[model samples]
Target: MQPDSSTGLNGKGQDLKIVSLISIGQHPASGRARRAEQDGRAVELGMTLAASSSTQNLTVLHAGDSQQAALRSYAGMGLESVRVLQLRESADAVKTLSEYLHKHAPDIILTGVRAESGESSGMMPYLLGESLGWPVVSRIADIVSIKEGVAEILQALPRGQRRALTVRLPFIASVDNAAPEPRQSAFGPANRAFMEQQQCHSEPDTARNGWSIVSARKRPKRLKIVKAKTAADRFKAATAKPQGAGGKIMKNQPAAEQAQAIFDLLLEEGVLR
Candidate 1:
């Protein structure tokens, strides 16, 4: 690979073994099998990291059915192959995945913040990090640069902000939705890339069997949202309810001026504080 100034490295970065974990995604509305959104972004992030460096060591991995069509959908995004560890449906994924990751010992591991199917507990990365004793960075937007033996990371924060961090080599990161969107999947590569499978030891989720799974309570209807471009428009709409006998109703005034009057009234009444 050629040297890139953006990576903050003197030359090409060392061959960084990158592994992106994928899972069978379920569409929320349709309840159909599909490629997961965040996992796809994880793969996209992995591709970006691999393309910037010297070696092509990016491996897309799954720990479930090899015959699932969703896996191919991921490969359609320019992967030559996807590695699958064959395990039964009843088996627990965390233990098997931890074992596989420990054996390979990749330099960087990428995964979605949470799975789209099943429990969706959003704890896979943390569990794996704890098991492997590797540093775990959660909800990261991007990896800004890598140099010598450290990586500069941009972690996503609340309210669309970002926090910069630097961590040493060999860490796991959970890609957030705030990261770059994934490339469109193509039919050719997806159809051509094969599922490389290997039989792995599996343990039944005996604990899960004992716990009863219940459907989550439906969310209450949300309040109607009124979008306004300006503060005056917002104030007019928000305070436009039917005027009660005790309420003051102004007339023959420009909307901007009326809004200003209301604002002043509210401010003086301690309602705008």
Candidate 2:
């Protein structure tokens, strides 16, 4: 007998549901732009998935601390009623997030490849999946289709190649830059979302972890503040700098001559000891 295709189990057809858990922003000190890009990708992929499977239930969730950066990033996404799950800064964030997902029981959970804070651990999805006994697909570029209880995922590999994968329901996927560009948020939807707040109830602290508020006598600003009116200006400034403009390329030279030329260039540029 042919194996079940719809359910990917017993051939029984079942409805699919998707829940995207997007992280808003990194800590004040983190230097990587991956988190912001990932958040945008999550929303873009979630919107695409929702549109493709209009019949399936879809919900977008934001899981992170209440930092100013995080809140602003998520609030500006123009998402419809994001579910905010807050946890203590010193608490086990992974455990807290996992517990929430267990209760929510979404068929598919989407998160970024990693967070840019304290741990900067790209292990959230894997750890969360392990804790919840669900499969995880990292660096997922797109969701090709969702049928019955299985989803067709497109994993982005190195060198711009893609791999097709099929995973059962109740899985986690970490989005990457290979996904489509995020849409420009509509001001009307963003303004309306404030009226419909969906805040998740904070779980009680069970783990015994000491908490101490360290008050500084003279609090020194620890964050770097760059004032830019627009994101395009910021992007242009970041990638505009060019290095090694006067370097020479010596082709058809002997190996010994090439080595000497490189050493001379390094000395001329003060890059060699």
Candidate 3:
């Protein structure tokens, strides 16, 4: 392993260049304050990976309103500076991000699996990867290693299982929440960090909003098994079907017979042993 002085790489072999895509999330509390979304944890994971001696550089990128507070929250997590692609709220985010990435390609682009707000299709990474013609990996727990233009990744799976995958360079990844929690934001670093904004002129995608959206008073009560403690329990809950429309109404029936019917239904639904 040799260090590349020009690239600021330490004595490890792979030339690790990383970019973390960040976004604003609704605050945990009801009112004013803002936060980096749950997916922002991916950026923190990227930062941790870059902190390793093997990595060359880690850059943070965001395409959103310039004055958003979430940007500062990210900086507080120890990013020296964040690169901004200034965009309007109505701008096509996918296009804007893809355009910026195309001009300046990195070895790896990291983002959260999905955003928490506003048409959060969670398709940005996939779309960006498609635009760049690079493979996109989702639910990534960790980067095991990067060597000789190939990256070994640990993919998170259900039931606490992890799968190993090796992919060629210049790819996008959506980090899983199963990864380690991000570091807390600090006031000092956040206040000192510099922001470099670049103007973007991508057109807004109006087609997505063409469909009518309506809110109803009550949503259907989904069938869910509460307090699942095992993989089987979770699986059962996820696959469980809800009861059909209505049940037989017992009128003028014996009390003992009605009790038996109710008990039978409970057993069939697994509500009672």
Strongest candidate by lDDT = 1
Task: Give the runs in model 2 whose Cα sits over 4 Å from its true position.
Answer: 1-15, 26-35, 53-56, 66-72, 195-273
lDDT of 1 by residue, 177-261 (tens): 9999999999999999988999998999897787765645665754547899999998888788653355667899899999998
Q: Is 2 or 3 the stronger prediction by lDDT?
A: 3
Candidates' lDDT values, in order?
0.87, 0.65, 0.77
Sort every candidate by TM-score, greatest first: 1, 3, 2
Which 10 successive residues of model 2 have the least lDDT summed? 1-10
Q: What is residue 133's positional error in candidate 3, in angstroms?
A: 0.9
Which TM-score value belongs to model 3? 0.72
Off by over 4 Å in 3: 1-11, 28-33, 53-56, 211-273
Task: Pick the winner on lDDT between candidates 1 and 3.
Answer: 1
Clashes, model 2: 0
**Residue 231 of model 1: what lDDT?**
98
Model 3 lDDT per residue over 60-95, tens place:
888878788778988998878888899887778888
Off by over 4 Å in 1: 1-11, 214-273
Which 10 residues in a row give candidate 3 its minimum summed lDDT?
A: 1-10
Clashes of each: 0, 0, 0
Predicted candidate 2 versus true structure: per-residue lDDT over 18-81, tens digit per residue: 6766664543455432336676777677666655543545566655554433444444556556
Q: What TM-score number comes out for model 1?
A: 0.77
Cα lDDT, model 1, residue 92: 93
